[model samples]
Target chain A: MKMRVHSSCSAAFSARCSRQVAPRAASAQAPPAVQVDDFDFQKYVMATAEKVNVALDAAVPMAYPETVHESIRYSLLAGGKRVRPMLCLASCDMLGGEESVAMPSACAMEMIHTMSLIHDDMPCMDNDSLRRGQPTNHVKYGDDIALLAGDALLAYSFEHIARETKATPEQIVRVIAEVGRAVGSIGLVGGQVVDIKSEGKKVPLETLEWIHVHKTAVLLEASVVTGAIVAGASDDDVERVRQYGRNIGLCFQVVDDILDVTQSSETLGKTAGKDLDSEKSTYPALLGLDESRKIAQRLNEEAKALLEPFDAEKRAPLVGLADYIYSRTN
Target chain B: MKMRVHSSCSAAFSARCSRQVAPRAASAQAPPAVQVDDFDFQKYVMATAEKVNVALDAAVPMAYPETVHESIRYSLLAGGKRVRPMLCLASCDMLGGEESVAMPSACAMEMIHTMSLIHDDMPCMDNDSLRRGQPTNHVKYGDDIALLAGDALLAYSFEHIARETKATPEQIVRVIAEVGRAVGSIGLVGGQVVDIKSEGKKVPLETLEWIHVHKTAVLLEASVVTGAIVAGASDDDVERVRQYGRNIGLCFQVVDDILDVTQSSETLGKTAGKDLDSEKSTYPALLGLDESRKIAQRLNEEAKALLEPFDAEKRAPLVGLADYIYSRTN
Candidate 1:
């Protein structure tokens, strides 16, 4: 009975196109292809991300174990979209709170995200040699230092959230636990493990969906959830945003898989088609590229729908983000 | 002037011989060594560590991304003495408090320590093949998973403290900052950085002292200081005990150097002679064997002196710990 409920709600969204289930018209409200140029939300997001990036660079010191500290610095300074943290800051803003109130959480999420990237790009895991248009952390600093730098960043993230943020201790405590849950065995780490194990194997579709949800989606959801918590958003409000984040996170990854096949490494700043090369199961691999794109369009609509109760002025960026996730080619 | 004061203090303590520094005189005047043994203290520490270990084990589950989850569990459950956490637990007992109050702090310290160990044993840092008589985490889990595991553990440490401890929010905030300093550039990571940079070089004694004190002693001192904080001990008292811990931590490392030269891997549970082979400026390398022993002895005396204000019953184990450190051949 529990399994059916679990399969119906959270897992069903990802499993919509499976042969066992037919897609309904209600679930098929394909989001309009909003041109990226029309929304200027990208500019806001990019500007917000740039501020967080600069803040992160200023925050992490250059002084560390010489061999490993350089590696940590290299990875942190390596550029990315900083989407998760920017989303958090935006979420707080949407909840009628100051961005400063969410800055620490923003920085922490970025650090945690960067740490994951360092580990994910190592020779032993994804074994990629590049990130953000440059050599990956292990490639630049060697494996050992890369590993330690990641650990240092992770440690610093918690400390930063707890100390630098203005939230009360009780609130900090809640965010801290959520951060842990986002990355622990049940969060990002849990998802990566399954991804690795399923590589080159014909695994069940549900298992693959689990991997992406726990690994990629949980942290994304956590970003909004943490921001909402800090901004004093109601629990129901937080849950709605969480659901919004979940659909968008998966939609984001589905777009990524589509891009892996469609885009170039130069365009993506990371290995393109590498997932396919590794024989990893992806949305495109399961449902074909056209079907994956359709699923992503559907999920984006669902995500935007979840935000209907939110004030329209506040939710513009979120709705815009759903469009952005599906529209990005790289 | 500050440098001179630091140098004089270090030289004064570093110059003394071990035999002259042993607490034989103090123990003889107070209580017999045999009478001072507290079996219950050991049992209490063990019990507390066990409870934390159980909580940690249950905390990390093999869920989605089973491999990464398992990888995190592999490193976390890998056995060690749980000494850092024990220090927090023991300090609480010394201040007449229940282990429950200190348990979260204890667990947090252990997690930070474990994260360091995980990184330290990586191929880039210490490059150690073994830890706690087992293959290093990276060796068992691969560098990527090992890196991620350390990150998850480090971040989760603060999470555990913030969520689980009964201390005030202000106190939890303070503790998080303290732990960050101990783990960051000013503390363990900084020391490690210097140590790595100084490898095979003729570094000044002062710089070497900074490396050990920051890298190793800071966290060790933090364990004791945090325990006192958890018990609401006065700042002055905490400072005094911190000095005590600092002295002992340095002595402990000096003793460790001596053992590395004198003991076999079979007895020490780690490969010995790495310092000698690596040309790391250990105590034995800097002071010669006879002088290093004397230095250890003197440091031991200074450590015990700080505990004079505490009751003999409360301080016996701490003092005993000093003796046990030097007594160990391995």
Candidate 2:
């Protein structure tokens, strides 16, 4: 497959090129010669995000006990990049799975992601008042309701997948077990605990990597792997997707850390410099900005390499997603 | 299938005799009448509680990120009646399943119960400082860690069941789905929202029952049903156990409401008069104390009646558990 560059990048990504060693040159060196320009990465992301939004809107409703439902809906329905769900859907699509079959798991991934955000923004946690350009759940509802809403979302995530997925019971069970592990103590919560304890301390790079791997990478890995499992991918294929997910997952956080210092609060839609303000060790803090950017670029390339063996056309969206995750820094 | 009653009631239960509308007379009317002094209900409860404690102690380890594990262990290991787990174990035992096969789900029940308690004790929720005669999780660990710990437990509940359950994958999936429903918006979380919303207001008896059914009964229902499911119970058998669980589950809450009015905080191990202080509707608040006690007794009998079809000796623990739940108010 011949590779060509997409000419149009979003304005948000424009700033990324100036700050780092050239990413395009690095990505150009390794490829199965694919025509990238034929695949509109931005259009794919926006389309997938739109579908995910519609599915998510239907996933949670404002029912009885309106406050709790409202609290869950408020954060969930609020707009985001929809990266997790998009990744999930794209992975499923690449494996010849119907979007309808994968929709519930896709929505479940988003719900899980939203839950972490809701709890992470609690007063006792990050004490943040804003998220995604609006008041956080705790700010809109009280802390008790916010916490409950997060919990409801977490529980609902598993229920939604089990109830809605058209996959076989075996696939559904595997998905549930995998997703459960991704969010359990040894996963998201485990990482958050370590991150919390390490705050304001001079932390080792190994510890920082541990935190991100558990907190961030595991869930992303779950998202991609669940989609593939639902689509009935073989073990080898699933493992390959998992590696791609892990690489891009870590890259997602590394870029996020880079944006914390580089972007304005308006552009990021969250408090800029909060990481530095809290003295939390980040990729940029631990490694210099140039080193961090280079690492993120390398991770993005490695994630792409994992997908090279697949049909280039089928893997286009995923390949593009890795670039988008890195390109967000612009 | 002979049915018998235990003659000696604990001192706490002696007072229940006069207020209840002749529970003995109601029970005596049922068939398979045998000696009342044969089974020791209290002994069975204590033995089952001890086994549950040992299983729970091994369920969560003080691994790395000891803080979250500690927070989970702190509340989980803290003493409670272990009523849910006992019911689960008893249900599985009645179905001729090994206790080892049911232990994971039993531990999951306790974990889920502890999660609801921890979140309920948050400052913004019930705002209670004491639980199980010790400081609540939020009081011991900061609210942040407590919230995370609760989330961790909820996720781990599913993981523990999925990973540790010896049942078929289909059964494990069904259990996970059932539990997710139990704790989701339509179950524990939903009931809590209504309870919080109804605070300080005059709620109807219907609404009070709704709150108790969803908030309390569902988890207990899940506990028993999951155990039966894990044991590969027949559909008819599962349905019977579910009914038994529902009756006792509702009975569990009604007795709790009665005790809140009749017992001391020291006796309850958590603050008493909380329902009155918060002015939230309870069974006793909607119905008179005598009526509530009568309802609790009636529920206990109805629960026992459902077990009449099963082998009496096999169901002894469950039958005795219904008595223990009601006897707690004594």
Candidate 3:
């Protein structure tokens, strides 16, 4: 396995670098041999994420009126894990494609995700003061500017995919459709509405599950599937990647819910027990701690299973990613 | 013209349908027919608007985790003029293109526009209590939903362009870029930021122009250019169409300014003099009513001149549209 370990997080991800799936048990198991680690995949994914940020920034304020450019820039550059876009680039690499072809779509996915976050933090909605350890746009720039910024980012994401990259016409079209489906009623936005509506009400478990799957999972699916499509993967391959993304996304959320309960605000960069504070439905809230933990473990395994057909080396980063997701305490 | 008239208002339009461009001055000197008055364009644009609305209503509430999606949908479906999409569809007609190719782009444009409006009405922004004669989304659903609704619409707009339309991928891509440019900081969002920043301060005339052109005119330009592009018009033809749209857009704003001063709330269906009440810089404020009126007239004439090369029949609707734009008191 090739490695591009940044010193700051080295200790934390050393075992992860080997690309071997971590043992599900809490007790320390010896790390798997490093032979299967695919360093190129991780590097490619990160590099593409950076490139996407740059492209997104360049494409925005310049394309809009200067008055609102700074606000748009605020959220566009707001740092995050860049997970969704990384999924796009990594999946592309895993399927025998270069990042260049998939870069636009990768950037687009991030733009869409970032836009959602910006809007989600507005005074009218979440009214959140902070995100990813920074003041929300509405807090920094005021609500109007924040709103326009999010709007610009969303609109610009599609333009970036359509105009910035040279993907095949069919690919571009498919990407657009995929993006729409993820963001539309059956996907991200739809999920958001139901989630909001369920607030203060005791939501059915099925309803809660549907919300998570649509709002959070759909875009995750889009991120991975888009990469596969850009790489010209077969439909079956795309579906497999989507399944992997879905499991990982859910695992990621479940961990987030757990961390909200267990971690300090200082580490999480958000209020601890936010879900509890808000009385929002969460896995642990619905299933209890032990049951939720089991669910996360099962999901991690399911995600791993989806990647089984790919070369062991090609699948390393993804498998490692599943472990890393489940491992996050904050 | 092959026209489908669905409503009583639209039925009148078919009766008066003529492919020939009305003599330009004839409309200016006499009462010009407003297409919004014409039942076909009115009904067609309206139906398209409704379609967009349905999609918006269905999609915006999908945001996951509950509270978010509810917040997004509450405001997005509130009534609007649906002008952006209508302009897009009208532009397609001017280019002799089928509506099928232009429908998605038209809907996307409206979504972008609606996103802007929703954000503008937030409690932290204009903080308006009413929109389209109804309680603003924030006023009804709370600020959170309004914020999310705007975000969902913006993201969905691009997705719609990419996924729903039958236009070629290149066309979809181009439309996305065109619309994105209109929404970005350099465009509507940028103008808005400047507008907010410049509030209570004297801004340069150039800066003010920059704000309006990017914020308002760019989308208008995009509306027409996208229509032409999807319709497969020649570049020169598209440029010509854009010139026409540009003139009309400016003229429309000028008229709006006039209406803001002269029209009553009952006639306008929204707050009248809201611009003056806010002390916002407007054409009437900047240039005074008489001069603004003249400017609108000149703009209307210039807009007509751009359509001179179009076959006389194809130019009729636009010429009438220009006259109606300038002549309207509200």
Q: What's the lDDT for all of these models?
A: 0.73, 0.84, 0.70
Q: How does chain A of every candidate compare to the true chain A by TM-score? A: 0.87, 0.93, 0.87
Per-residue CA lDDT of model 1 for A98-153, tens digit only, reads 88888888888888888899888877678899788898888877675666577667
| Clash counts for all predictions | 8, 9, 45
Rank by DockQ, highest first. 2, 3, 1
Assess chain B of each prediction and give its TM-score: 0.86, 0.92, 0.80
Every candidate's DockQ is 0.46, 0.74, 0.50
Query: How does the DockQ of candidate 1 come out?
Result: 0.46
Q: Candidate 2 - CAPRI tier?
A: medium
Which residue runs does candidate 1 get wrong by more than 4 Å? A1-39, A64-70, B1-21, B24-79
Give the per-residue Cα lDDT of candidate 3 at A256. Answer: 75
Query: A74-109 in candidate 3: lDDT tens per residue?
Result: 777776667777788779889988878888888888
TM-score of each: 0.86, 0.93, 0.85
Pairs in steric clash, model 2: A1-A33, A1-A34, A2-A33, A2-A34, A2-A35, A3-A34, A12-A330, A16-A330, B12-B330
Candidate 2: C-alpha lDDT:
0.84
Q: In model 2, which runs have C-alpha deviations exceeding 4 angstroms?
A: A1-5, A10-30, A33-35, B1-5, B8-37
Q: For model 3, how does the per-residue alpha-carbon lDDT over B1-330 read when each residue is reduced to its tens digit?
A: 543221232332232223212334544543333232323445444566687677556544453344545545555555655556666776787787887778777777777777777778777778777676777767777766666666666767777677677777777777777877778756777777777776766666677667666667788788889989998888998888788777877777777888889878877766787888777878778888888877777887778777766655555555555555556544
